[model samples]
Target: MFIYQKLRDSILKRQLAPGNQLVESVISDKLNVGRTPIRGAIRKLAEEGLVNVIPNRGAFVIQPTKEEIVQAYEIRMELEQLAARLAVPYMDETDYEHMQRLCDEEGETIQSSDFRAYLQVNKDFHMTYIRKCANMFLIEFAERMIDQTNIYLMLYEMVFFHTSPQTAPGAAEHRELIQIFRDRNEELAGMKVRSHIANAMKSLQIDNIQFSNLGDIF
Candidate 1:
């Protein structure tokens, strides 16, 4: 479990660059763990879409293609729209307040140039209404898509740090979503969900981008 957490954090934080192989023996020596545990940890990461295990080859950090990211967001948009429709009836004052607080916190992260912190808050904002859906199957699938998008965002959205404040993403849209939810209009909520995700997906242009190799496959 410790190895899994370490490897997961490394991938999520971009400490382990995409397409880098999870070389068993090298990782074993570096983490002071054996090959068995490293293999186990890698399998876990692969299950989470953070790593790709290729048969006859080896495990590597997932280097998601632009098509993959866009497809994931398209699926996410449909699921989130459904989630918003179902979630609105269950949403209460506390959920609304929490979402607003997260939106505010996100703005602070932008000011401080704390991108990792912003990603966490952004995840919380979506999960706030998402959890209210009360459908475990939908919730699980939706969360997976969120995780994938977060990873994509982590790889791309860091560009915000060097750009103008006016160009910073999500905060305005989140505030708008918060109001839509407060209105308790499920139809409008679903429409907003579609636009919200579409806009986020549009911002990430991964075309022709190359990742630096961190390690080779054994």
Candidate 2:
């Protein structure tokens, strides 16, 4: 358990760092653990996409690339667009208040520059509606994909979008999304949600998504 936590946190915190080799003998020596559990933990990390285990060659940490980040955001945009439309009929005052609080908390976290906290609040904000949309299939599908894609999103934000989360298209954008939910304007809400998602990537200079002109990456 300790070895597992240590290795997982090292990847998340990037202590072990990306592309670094995870030599079991070295880890066993460093953490004073046996090879059995160390191997077990590496397999788990590999399953999560945090580490890529190569046969004969040892595990290496994931280095989230630009293409991977774009793919993840694309997947999220589709899920959230559907979720935005589905959540309208189900939303009540309680849901509104909860979402409002999350938006506010997200702003506060941005102000404080608590990156982890801001990310957590942001995920919570999205998941709140996602879980309430009452479509178990959509909910489960989003959860599974987001769980994997979120790691790449974190890498992108940390590496590329830095303090933007504190400024324009961050908290203000979140507030607008909340209002869209309040309006229960399903089509408009979906459009706005899609725009919000694309805009985030636009900041990174990746403006080549032609829905009509589909490509290989699709």
TM-score of each: 0.79, 0.79
How well is each residue in 1-218 modelled by candidate 2, as lDDT tens digits? 77777777655543554667777777776666699998898888888788898888878877667777778778878987898889888988898899889988877777676766776887788788788778998888877666666575444344223454446465777788788888889888778877877776555432221211101111
lDDT of 1 at 10: 70
**Each candidate's lDDT (Cα)?**
0.82, 0.71
lDDT (Cα, tens digit) per residue for candidate 1, span 108-158 = 888888877887888899989999999999999998898889889876655
Query: Using lDDT as the measure, which candidate wins?
Result: 1
Instruction: Tell me the spans in candidate 2 whose CA falls farther than 4 Å from its real position.
Output: 159-168, 202-218
Candidate 1 worst ten-residue window by lDDT: 209-218
Pairs clashing in candidate 2?
none
